[model samples]
Target chain A: MNGVKRLSAPLNEKQLLNLRAGDEVSIYGVIYTARDAAHKRIYEIIKNGDKMPFDPEGQIIYYVGPTPPRPGRVIGSAGPTTSCRMDKYTPLLLEKGIKAVIGKGKRSEEIKKSFIENGAVYLVALGGAGALLSRHIVRAEVIAFEDLGPEAIYKMEVEGFPAFVCYDLYGRDLFEEGIKKYRKE
Target chain B: MREVHWERISKAVAELFKKINYYLNEDVYNALKKSLEIEESPVGKRVLCQLLENAEIAAEERIPLCQDTGIAVVFISLGQEVIIKGKNLEDAVNIGVAEGYSEGYLRKSVVRDPIKRINTGNNTPAIIHTEIIPGDKIKITVSAKGGGSENMSAMSMLSPAAGSEGIIDFVLETVKRAGPNPCPPIIVGVGVGGNFELAPLLAKKALLRPLNEKNEDEFWRNMEDILLQKINSLGIGPQGFGGRITALKVSIETFPCHIASLPVAVNIDCHCHRHWTIEI
Candidate 1:
């Protein structure tokens, strides 16, 4: 793993290229939250030639459905959910110019290939580290699908949100290396 | 007959859910701490450290440990000598669950049906498992089982002669396949020799045992050690980043089975095993 790098959201090509699998990053700026249900909604919206709740271009979508914020708090224990469930709709979002994604667990081989092809990256926040990650979220507002409750689309303003690059633009995958390094015969 | 009011049952369930969701069980917390001390991979250690910090934050701040507060799984050991008064037992527990999730601001993650997906709005209709025992008091254990780990669990009907080796292999294969998805330093709860359906139940129940507690039976305790060693050797590590501490503990609970069947089930519990028990 490389030293920690700092990057802004809606990452540019240069910023994306700088990321390699296993590199730690502290991301700042706007990110959006959408889990399985929200992704399905977004996919249908695109299929029907309709607009998404937010601009798809140059945006990072975090696979998350945060617990509702308590009174006077910006958010609850907000952390990334498992990302594998989003495999079906992720490539479609990438094709639409989505820049990066954040979640835990490995993506499918096909999704990783798309990340390389589309110059996108997948970030991993430690799973089950929800309360710790919430400290990084400065603000959260439901931008769409409020009926889905916690599954609604949230416009999140984050500062120094910590994650590691698990899948990168160049087709590197940290999870693969992780198993190889430690698996005993 | 000892009479227990439905309101008391509901209140107990609600309070248990609220407490367990926000607080990490001391056994699980200590196991994670011990795992952190010996985790070989730097990344794995870092992840474990974050999990530790998350637990502290959740407990101190009174927030749900993870956003997925989970489908409520309640294990009730009812005393045969006691009589429950009020709404039926299941209804009372569901009412308590609804109150707990709503009042405590925990996420309501239960869907109405597996085939027809619809959010239940309030986390209700808990997966309740009840057993009658000879006592005047009842024991209830509530576990907030997260979906990620629960999805990784598996059951198999091994050949009758497959024996202990077969059981070991099944548990190993399950953890290997689970990889990072179940959130390692997982607790492997293995149920061997029970009937097909009961095997999984036994496996889930095994998870309620404290990490530091060994199986009361020597043979099973040794089996737990072997399985745990083999699992950690797979290098799944913390959060599946690769390390020597893939599992914090392996608990096996068994029951006599029919001669024709050797059913084995593996139920994986994430490091954030949110479960608590109270005697009422």
Candidate 2:
């Protein structure tokens, strides 16, 4: 098990603060999937003063656009998209009470700052390991923006979904620290 | 003259996309295995292991290796002495791509227009690059490029005087800025000396070559080795978690150009390397 930390969805402030960068986490329970288009729409809903599709309080948002599953599978190759594309929209979501976000790649300095202020965390999944990650997603159902196809938000039930803490509430960044530590000249 | 049907092209294109998406190429697979033995960071080692396992699971289960099955980029070489029976070359390729994505259950990632941003649903209208050669055979290569890595690609027009050092610096800077965004342990394809358009195409083509293949010319061969070393030393490591194996390979392609132009382009490929070729 390599001391892998077990976590559940809708993480609390204490749990978010306890995590450290680079800690391998096995997450369970509900995590919502949203990528570029859905984020835009969610942001619009907020801008228009409409009721949010789902409450964002203490919820984990996974940035993904999964493939269509084969007949027997619940989901297809599901993995993290780049985190940077959602950078412009993240602060608003954080303010709306998103506790954690999961994806691959770098987040902006402002996004990191937002994480600290909101007491949220940033985690990343294995970017291209969709087949491996799909095994942990036991259920998936589109909850909004079905028109967006793969880009729609899906409420999913996950079990032992693998991720690593990339940004914690203290404003530490795994990507920045890891690169600096290993960079030679 | 030889006669080839468009349907065969479509069938091959469809099969090729499916095969490439579901199965990791043997060279890339072996490289990851080798990297596992040498990666120093514990998390980097774990990531390498997970990638190998992902490939196995993808192949065994017959699902795509990644959700971003990628925009279809096809390169075709048609023999000058050949005739198509069913459809035009471009139409045949796009039809094949549409069939493959829909039938194989690959994600439809392409937007109808760059600005409008509407999904085409079937993943049609593949980006096709074609050339006419001497023989009567048709050769095609299909690559699925993920948006995450593709968006990080860059190009620049340097002064002819900037020379090789300038290129090294540009490529290094691009990698540094990309950090983990392109999904490190990336494959960097560099093109030098072509015009604005050709330079990027040449860079994209460099990615289609096998990871184990080195450039034929001695200068380019050494350049590849140097870039590989420099990139790995960046220590972005696998998925930018940080470690010794940031880049698995760096391939450069070049062409003669105007003395005044020194255009260079770097196209980054994620570790998936979803490319396959067929000859007919």
Which candidate leads the pack in lDDT?
Answer: 2
For all candidates in order, the CA lDDT equals 0.90, 0.92
Can you tell me the DockQ of model 2? 0.79
Model 1, range A15-47, lDDT digits (tens) per residue? 998998888899999999999889999999999
lDDT of 2 at B251: 93
Q: Which residue segments of model 2 deviate by more than 4 Å?
A: none
Deviating ranges (above 4 Å) for candidate 1 = none
Candidate 2 lDDT by residue in tens digits, A56-117: 99899999999999898899999999998999999999999999899999887888898888
Q: Residue A55's C-alpha lDDT in candidate 2?
A: 90
Give all TM-scores, in the order shown.
0.98, 0.99
Model 2 per-residue lDDT tens digits across residues B93-190: 99999999999999999899888899999887888999999999999999999998998899999999999899999999998888888877789999
